[model samples]
Target: MTDRRGVVAKRAEDLMPGVPYVRGWNRARQSASALADQLVLLGLDSDFPGLVADVNVVGDGLVQLGTVRPEAAELLATLIAAGLRAELHGTTAETPATARREAPAA
Candidate 1:
């Protein structure tokens, strides 16, 4: 929750083919990959799985998480994994265990 500057600036008018999204870089939590394993969180075979909306590395140790659309708990998890941490912000928490039961991995 360092700063949502990126998230706040997102426009619903610029969504991708599959879902709307936002992108921003984190200065505090630098991801070896993307913020919050968003890719993995998105589940495999998803269109635009790891689409980052806005990204910026600033001077202060702060990672700005951008906006996300079709904002689902699953998608949020992925964003958080990239580097942005959200506390008490979970509403759609779905794990692989339940996923297997629902769609069973191929």
Candidate 2:
């Protein structure tokens, strides 16, 4: 028998089956706060949050998006290809924040 706790840690993608992946970041030397501000300025804040349900600032440069609709997911992909530096996972089973918080402490 194997100790469940001893199992290898799963990447976010592994744990979130069917969950969409989304990532975005500021290209310039700007903080995540600034990036969020830019999203607001671009009029994306209003819909993006509701669409994704969770938007997390990773470190000082990157932002992660939680679950989102197909159209929103497509938009995120298009943004990435268009130089927004975004990443998409697939879809989300739960809020990414909840997943992170539920992770065992290292």
Give one digit per residue, the lDDT tens place, for model 2 in 1-106.
1138844222332324343334322332244456457556544455456322222222122233445656555544444443432225443343334433443442
Which ranges in model 1 have alpha carbons more than 4 Å from their true place?
1-29, 32-38, 41-58, 73-94, 97-106
**TM-score per model over all chains:** 0.27, 0.32
Q: What lDDT would each prediction earn against the true structure?
A: 0.40, 0.40
Query: Model 1, range 1-106, lDDT digits (tens) per residue?
Result: 2235643333343344533232223333455245455445545324333444333222223233443444344544454453333245545544544543454222
Model 1: how far residue 38 lies from native, Å: 5.2
**What range of 10 consecutive residues in model 2 has the weakest lDDT sum?**
52-61
RMSD of 2: 17.2
In terms of lDDT, model 2 sits at: 0.40
